[model samples]
Target: MIVVERTFTVTATPGAVLGYLQDFANAQEWDPSARRTSRVGSGPIAPGAHWRHIRKMWGVTTELTYTLIAAEPDRLIFHGRSESATCTDLVVLHPVPGGTEVTYRMELELHGLAQLATPLLRGEFEKLATGGVTAVTAALDDLSRPAGLRRRLGAATPNRLPTPAEETGI
Candidate 1:
């Protein structure tokens, strides 16, 4: 079993962060490892929703079925399963002065013969987890900006707008 937890702050409200993350299919937008992610059966996004996520790592592609295990205004928990491993992802959001603070935790449990390689794979997993969190923060910060600012910043990375206090010098 390997676990990676990271915390970052974004220029968006807790509600905005949660709304963007609640839909697991959106992983493709922020996760560099994700080849594709899609909702298995779509209606409302809530507990019990499912997503099919395909990710490529170290030149090997793997597919996992992820289920939404818990949902709240400020937190979300998901469980994923594949042939060789099981994964749990937990995301928590907190209100902050400028925006929101996000804590993301991921746990991976390898089965069968793969468990033996856990030590060797720990470093790689840590790298991926750090990169994933950075990407998520970038995506959310970009999405929080207005269209005009986003366009000027760049199509790839939108600019984050200043808060009302900053604008009024309050």
Candidate 2:
């Protein structure tokens, strides 16, 4: 078994932060470890909502299915399993002085051959999880910043802006 946890202080309110985080489709936007994520069921996120994700780790691609185990306005817990392993992930949001305190934790169990490689794999997994947290934190920060400031700072610039068509010369 391996576990990793990270906490970040984000400028957004807990409700706002959780709203974005709970959107399964947004995982790829904030979670650096996720190559892609898609909702598997219809409707909003709630208990029993399922998501499938492809994540890259150690230069290998892996797929997992995550089922929402618990969902509250301020907290969410999910369990994910692949054919080869199982893991639980918990995310908590707490109101803070300036913003919100977001904590993410993951616990994983390796089976079969994976178990044999656990000793070598644990450290890397921990590092990967930590990086994911950092990426989320940074993304939240960017999201919380004022739009004007974000534009001026050239951070997280959007992909397209309307441009006037060039006049044709006769």
TM-score of 2: 0.80
Top of the candidates by lDDT:
1
Cα lDDT of model 1 by residue, 1-170, tens digit: 99989999999888889888998877877777887777876589899998878889888898888999999988899999999899999998999998999999999998998789899778888998888888788878876798677522212421222344765999
List ranges where model 1 is wrong by over 4 Å: 151-170
Clashing residue pairs in candidate 1 (N, C-alpha, C atoms within 3 angstroms): none
What's every prediction's RMSD, in angstroms? 12.2, 9.1
Model 1 TM-score (2 dp): 0.85
Model 2 misplacement above 4 A: 146-170
Q: Write the per-residue lDDT of candidate 2 for residues 1-170, one digit (tens) a residue.
A: 98888888988888878877776556676566677677875776778988877788778798888898988988988898997789898899999998999988889998788788778878887777676767777767766778776522213422222222422432
lDDT of 2 at 150: 55
Cα displacement (angstroms), candidate 2, residue 59, comes to 3.0
Give the whole-model CA lDDT for all candidates, comma-separated. Answer: 0.83, 0.76
Shift of residue 1 alpha carbon in model 2, Å: 0.5
